[model samples]
Target: MNIRKTLATLGISALVGLSAAQAVAAGTIKIGSFLAVTGPAAFLGDPELKTLQMYIDEINTKGGVNGMQLELVHYDTGGKAKEAVGFAKRLIKKDRVDVIVGGSTSGSTLAVIPLVEKDRIPFISLAGSVKIIDPVKKWVFKVPHTDRMAAAKIFEDMKKRGIKRIALISGSGGFGKSGRSQVLALAPEQGIEVVSDESYGAKDTDMTAQLTKIRNTDAQAILCFGFGTGPAIVTKNVRQLGIELPLYQSHGVASKKFIELAGAAAEGVRLPASALLVADKLPASDPQKGLLLAYKQRFESKYGPVSTFGGHAYDGLMITVRAIERAGGTDKAKVRDEIEKTRGFIGTGGIFNMSPTDHLGLDLSAFKMLEIKHGDWTIVE
Candidate 1:
């Protein structure tokens, strides 16, 4: 077998005969994944899968982690929770992946939580939802800043501007719904009132009606909490209706694709995001600057522009690998314990300090408030 070729390219033929223990004995570590690689949420999962493959390939090239070659067994969930459940089961039962790093959406991640916890396997989710780790499931950890964190960051920014009585337009999907709930739950404390609240279906073509409704309200600003193209459409609709009330978006649309999709309408739009989007603009003193720049260069060179979603995958995979290294092997229990013990681990998102009660290992500081300026990302102070 050519060691240079990524195990992801080896297909099932290579993973067939190795039992979980046998695979470890044969100097291989399996990392199973189930992502929405091809679906409405493709924007989130496509780059995620690519980032995983790229890093795994690079890691294997420089002598595998702890002298063991890494193998990936991934499945496409098409952004569906039911499909995610089936694929996750396959990964746990058949592929026997020592650790799982997947779930492009909150729905998918939440669906597979029971399975991972019951099976006693370590799972690092890439999706952004507080519920994924809020209750603190033993076997589950996550990379992206939670939706609740995003909400808090946005609310803090709004408070800074002395903005009150805001409108909320959200998507009905998992991330959007969760983010909306958090925003509502946290707004009262910030002295922000929900002047108008509306939601659009995940596949909704037009949000002009929602924008019109929000415009009629006595709202000071509008916050759109949604993922994929839905928020982009909302951005366009807000512009189309001439409703320029200082729009804010959730971290869901932190990718350059949102700017491209929403065109000039995206300009002046503010959102919470990772430093990955503005790597070059980050000050040299920032701890994540060097790592973010390196990851940006590598990913953009191989793929196109890097997205925060991909960065989430980068953190998840590296965190898992580091946990395995700390555990000295892929013993499930030990790895899980090490993952929970991760502290001061700098990643593309932020410095992680996980604990028994906090599996996500990130605070509001993990998100940098950003705005779209001149068709590019600009840091918002």
Candidate 2:
């Protein structure tokens, strides 16, 4: 009896070891990300990473997909493109993540694209630059409304207001450069003239010099295309230089932080933003109202308040999750195909309509014209 028991114990131990080996071979479905979690772009990446982690935990709580737990590995790129490229390679080659959702800034997204394309991995970027999807790389996709779309929306709004001459002041960042290009290229088609196009460094504390140049132009309206604190500086500079042209910012500064940064100077400033900014104000008839409200509540409940940048990350992660569910497995090719076939999916950014040719999947309608009133965001009726 003792000999028989000893043999059974050995057999059980060997079976357990083999099971462990098999588990290691199969591996969990890896979801990797790299964002500008620290540094100048922290405002964008902090909320994004938080929202992604929160939703991921929620998914795990409900039980992960296909009876396997999801594994998330993240790195901070400090809003630097070079840093982003290194991490992208590590996530794919070393960590072997099934899907990647990141590149918080446009520069970082553009930086990581070559590696993602070469590896043929499905990369859903949170970056806002239209250049991220313009060439239409098959393996790459994005969540934010393109800068081109935002520019078109702004120009259309300007035309409706009977404004003709506009000045463009952009930052040297990829996002600002992309916005400037689009606005310039589309202005003639839209029957508006760009009287002045000025640029400033991302870290420039003041833009009085650029505003001085813009003041000399016949611009009836001024478009300041930048993110983070650059736009705030423009607002202050515009007010200080006594330039009375209506100031319109890009959607990059569609957060309360901008108002706080610019203080009273941000008053009456106009910009384009997603419905998520004024979700509570949206009527019940609006298609995006429910989804926007739910997301806002969920995010703000845990992480203070929601930023439009955070919505970009939320869109990327949800789209990735939907693609995984639709594909029914961790097959990279199948998931990529599923993501490409996505359509009519209403997200925080817009109603996504992905295809072989259009990876960003947003339109001009995604933008809601907004104004800053008394340090608060109000939808321009």
Candidate 3:
């Protein structure tokens, strides 16, 4: 599948005037977004844009919340933090959007944090990083699982398989660096030992040197941390080197595109992923199964396949609407408080329980230990 062609196009209707605080004058409840729809992380941000647009169109058709039309003003950040910060300022200072849902990458999200906090605009980041919500910025929240959560889930599964010594090969990007820090920091606490640690840049096309160094170690399994094409390159390199060690990847690669990029080499790869990957395989009694299947069916009907990245956008948008309704108006402070009070909300990623101190709000049960089998996700038995 040519995912580039399948991705959603950027949608921006009109630019807001210089007055940033006037949502009413903007003519609707504006939702501003900054995503990486055309960059290296387009695999993630493109689908996210589609999901948000789909939901907004449906919501508007259904009379919208409190008899108000929701307008989306989004820009493509192209995986650049500085660009995202500029977009955040534009959304708040110029567009007069009531809420901002974006910052597709970990680095981009962090770069926009101070801007959002200073402006007092409610920010719901689509990026994956514990740093986004750890100390809890008053106006910031997230819908995806963090790098710390992914690391803990992988280590838990590794221990179950009697794997103790492991090797790490992570991209030098923000996502990889945060994941690497978590894995190394939690290894000793999880009863796992790191035998090797290697790094590669995001633009690096070959990881043969890193794989060779990792293979030389007495590592029982290898964990690769990266997003988009970088990890796929590592997978291909590991296979070409004829390495027998079990290869595991980060949730950043939770899409069919990764399997296609890695081809036959993707088989048997494991990762800690959101339940959306194997939603149909989940027990009917599970709370998130129905929600997951609904999203999958709707998304596949239009886009041909499903991805967790889009699911993150779906959850964030839905959550934003809910907060708007509970707040009873488009007031940014009221919406932020209502969002923080969100509890028992079922999202595509997991059950959300937002508090002032914890914003991401998902537990270990959110991720499943999944393996690639016959080019699809299957629960590792």
Candidate 4:
């Protein structure tokens, strides 16, 4: 998608500014965002922006929240940490946004942690990293499942299949680095041995060298830790090298785009992901099934296929809006407190039960073991 051109056209009416009616409305609640709209991580950030703009317009049509119209002022960070930090500062100081919701990657999210903490703005990150909330930054919260949770989920499945030794091929990006670290730290606890570990740069197109090295190891299975197009390349590389070992990927690639990118090579690939991808297949009684279907239908009808990254944006926006309603207004402190008190919130990601200590508010149950079969996501029982 031409996100740059789309954003340029949207800037006049939707995303970066308010409409004439909104400007003269009873009041306005400013929501600031910074995302990787045009970069290596555009696949993640593009859907997120589409979801936000679509839903925010929907919400505004419903008379906004607490009688005040919502204003979205966002910037494109291009997946850069330094750029994210600068935009975050501008969102807080210059735009004076009530809440900030963006940060499409762990590195970008982490870069602005100190700024959000010091500024005391209610910030909800779409990134997936345990470090974002491990120490419990008062103002920061996240929507996506943490990388640590993804690691534990994958290892749990590996143990179930009795796979003991595994090789790791990971990208050198933020998600890959954090996921690799988590896997290394948790492997021993799960009784799984890391036989060999290989790394690749973000821009690397070929991973045959890494897969060849991993093939020589005594590892029984391979776990790829990376996101974007990197892991997909690894998947294809593994198949090209005739590596018959079972392949596992991190949740960073839990979207249909990965399967499309990897093509037939994605067959038999497994990863941990939210139930959103297989919403139609989920049990009728599942709490998140209905919400997931609704989100998927809405997004697909307006834009294209739904993605897990977009679901993160959906949950983040809804949670923030719900908090605003509960607070009875847009009081930043009150909204943040309400957000912390969020209980039994059925989002596309999972049921969130936020508390003082836990900002992410999700357990391992949020992730489902999904395998690609015939170019589709099939739940692994």
Instruction: Pick out the ten consecutive residues of candidate 2 with the lowest summed lDDT.
Output: 21-30
| TM-score, per-candidate, Cα-based | 0.90, 0.91, 0.89, 0.90
Q: On residues 1-381, what C-alpha lDDT tens digit does candidate 3 reach at each position?
A: 465544432111123332443656454789999999997889789999999999999999999888898999999999998999899999999978999988788889999999889989999999998988988899999999999999999999999899999999998887889899999999999999999999999889999998998888899999999887899999999999999999999998987789999999999999999999999899889999989999999999998788899999998998999999999999999999999988999999999998888998899988998999898889875
- Could you give candidate 1's per-residue lDDT for residues 1-381 as a string of tens digits? 576565655655566654655746568899999999998889889999999999999999999889999998999999999999999999999888899999998889999999999999999999888889988889999998888888899999999999988999999977788888999999998889999989999899999988888889999999999888899999999999988699999888887779989999999999999888888999889999999999999998989888888988999999999999999999999999999999999999999999998898888888899999999999998
Off by over 4 Å in 2: 1-27
lDDT (10s digit) by residue, model 2, range 179-232: 889999989999999999899998889888888888988889999998879999
Question: Which residue pairs clash in candidate 3?
Answer: none
lDDT score, residue 299, model 4? Answer: 94
User: For candidate 4, what is the TM-score?
Assistant: 0.90
Error of 4 at 251 (Å): 1.2
Off by over 4 Å in 4: 1-26
State which candidate has the highest lDDT.
4
Candidate 4 positional error at 281, Å? 1.3
User: What lDDT does candidate 4 reach at residue 16?
Assistant: 36
Model 4: clashing residue pairs? none
The candidate, 2 or 4, that scores higher on lDDT is 4
